[model samples]
Target: MSYPISPPTVSFSSIIFTTTAYLLKYQLTRQYSNARMALAPSAPAHRVVDVISYLAAHPTVELSVSDIARGTGLNRTTCQSILLSLEPRGWVQRRSDLRYALGAGMIPLGEAALAGLQVVDELRAELDTLVAAVGLEALASVVSGDEIVVVAHARLAGVLSQTVRLGQTIPFVPPFGIAHLLHAPDGTIDAWLDRARVKFEPDERRAYRESIRFAEDRGYVVVLDVEARRRFEQAVSELADRPASHAARRRRDELVARLHREERSFGPWTGSESAEVSQISAAVYGHDGHPVAAIGVHAQPHQIDPSRISEHATSVLEAADRVTARIHGRNPAMSARRPTRHV
Candidate 1:
């Protein structure tokens, strides 16, 4: 039969247990300290990110101090204090009705931050896939200090003459440059044109005037360039018919032929000794529904003849939507060479 342990033995066991508990506590405390130290330098950016994340989750819903506090699990006073800090900077707005939403001023800052993050790599990779699938070229360009920088690009192997490279500057300003004008007030673009010493050809000038008026009317701009818009239209048109109708296939073939013709007229760029290049474009808006940037494609003219771009328009649009998201600071765009999650 077993007997109860003596008092001294029992005391020894209790001492061991206490020592083990203290050791574990020490280890856990040290680990937590290290983690806190690592995060300290990024605290402010983290807080701004937190604010942005909160806004993203609850867009278009009017938020109050208590609502924000409860949603973020912070104290009401703390929430109000943060909002106050954001207000003057135009990151958030307090309306006359006492409701709050994102501020108009926050847009550029958010866009700047998003651009700084290099999310465009993700977009380029996706575009590369599209190029292979469509047997054509896809590209993204950004306006950088008097040059259009082709930051991310993909092209089909069989096609040639696409000499565009990342970091290379194009003298021609992007058609979407008009966006800066639209976002500003009263002759801002005209003044900018004068300041930049830019002379617009008569047709180009008329086009810009017409485009700005049209964008204002529709609240957004969509380009119908041969590469992007034509492809999308072709895709939609193809989908309109089913079971591989002969008439539909014939129409698709015709559209593809048209794209080839456009490419030849537009190109000397695609290095192919034969099969010239064509391009198409479009633009989209933000949550506030403001036109942000233009999105489009460039491809070999012959590729357009089969309307092969239509087969890949969805991917092109997905990239464009991501770009639009970046414009509103919702996420990074593919053109910015930053890490962007798919929209």
Candidate 2:
């Protein structure tokens, strides 16, 4: 009845078969591509952890998602996923502006981590006392990765260093750099110095050697200028013979303790550009004679001189020792190794 049915140009069965085959092939290709992507080498987990740790340590920093991902060597998608997961766990916070930072979850963990780090805690009071006594800035710092972190700082009620604050990272350079070198083996120190490009050559090495030698002779090392170690030796020698009155020493220690309480009373440092001022830092060595942390006393260029610093060096050294003892506990063998001179 209908017009003669044209011989089916393509049979329904054939059409169905072709469509099915195409779909199957498409799906297979997609799955294969996905598998390859999955198998590809990805960013190392440790790198990711490093990024997270930095963010946790510096929470108030306004960092973009890409910035965070770049630090971790992760892609945006992956970093986003991590941020999302962390948000729920309260491990991190994403502001309305989408910057990520440490969250409330870190409070307990940070407390716990810090609880085990008694060196910082024990020295806090001493730092307070020192600031009060000297009417100068004082800092307690620890080595964190390749940098030093200021954990606590004390300033005379009116004297403040516009440069740094607690949790601020300080570059390891001369004076401060000496502490790192003191503990490192010659080869290690040499390599680091080279990498840091401090302009120290063979002669410079000899000078550094002489300075540290002098520092060892004295109870602490003091550098007068940026990257200068020559005065270190002089400072050490002065500290040895300089006589500090008992009353002065007591006053210094008490001030250091007060500074510690006041600085920490506010909470962890939240501001960016937490700058550190010019100061003298004494490296506190472990009972094993390893440099553990550094305690610094700061003042404006016009306010203090090398001679005054030498006078107070003894009290500062004692405070450093007390904190070190608490953190490392009693080790007769290790105790014997504590350097009479600060590194």
Candidate 3:
């Protein structure tokens, strides 16, 4: 009985502390295990979402399950399962050739999302008015990541009017995208150029620098003729098709250099059959004084007399100013200052 009493040296407080610690540890372990199981289900769902996003980004292209898997870096079987599940829900449609494209079901969702954008709502009337005044297509576009996305557009009444679809993503290249590059910061411009697989030669670099500087000073950039623009774009598309090899890049650079030289010599709006179309665009600035979007007017040589290009450009600048003022909630009077005309 005396020996048993000595065991009281291990106090009741110590016993309680040890038992409490053990229970706390057990509870934490159980919570962790449950959390891991709950999260495990999300992994597959995330992979499916990734597949949908990849397909969405390339809405025009029809891709097979293997292509989607390769693009999203998901297992083939996983992509197949996801696509199969989505097809039933009308989120995707599989073609007779087993290619998949975004289905009609996505339209309602897209419309709801676009309806929430204040800029789109505010610019709708302006775009419509500009189209009517210019007698040509008018487009509002913003830089989205590395591409330019057309958010809104108004088409003119003529058969020659350019047709642009909403939400169309265009490459950040000349002619179509020069307005954005003109207003972008120098570092951003450099990074965008670097993304092109083709390297620029010294002469090509100088020409681009001068062109951008000219646009920056004038607040707009002009595409002289449609022919030159089309040829250059065609060459660029060809370069994109080839593998990125040193020889291929060299060839691309050569083609670009030749185009630049030709453009310089051809002059702007010479009334040649090939040089019929001209385009002018002005940047729309946000509150930060950085350009967030561009509004542009396109005209045939007949529509805009070469002598009246300055006047047409002024109209575009005014439209762009209205957009800028609306976006930034600034006084419309602030944009009334006459912009310098550059032909």
The candidate, 1 or 3, that scores higher on TM-score is 3
Model number with the top lDDT: 3
| lDDT values for all models | 0.43, 0.49, 0.57
Writing each residue's lDDT as its tens digit, candidate 1 over 39-145 gives: 22344433444454344334457778777665555567766777888889876788887767766655554344335424354444455554554555666654443
Model 3 vs. true fold: TM: 0.58
Model 3 score (lDDT) = 0.57
Q: Candidate order by lDDT, highest to lowest?
A: 3, 2, 1
What is residue 137's positional error in candidate 1, in angstroms?
Answer: 0.7
In candidate 2, which residue ranges exceed 4 Å CA deviation? 1-82, 94-101, 157-161, 171-175, 180-194, 198-200, 226-277, 300-307, 325-343
Looking at candidate 3, the ten consecutive residues that score lowest on lDDT are 1-10
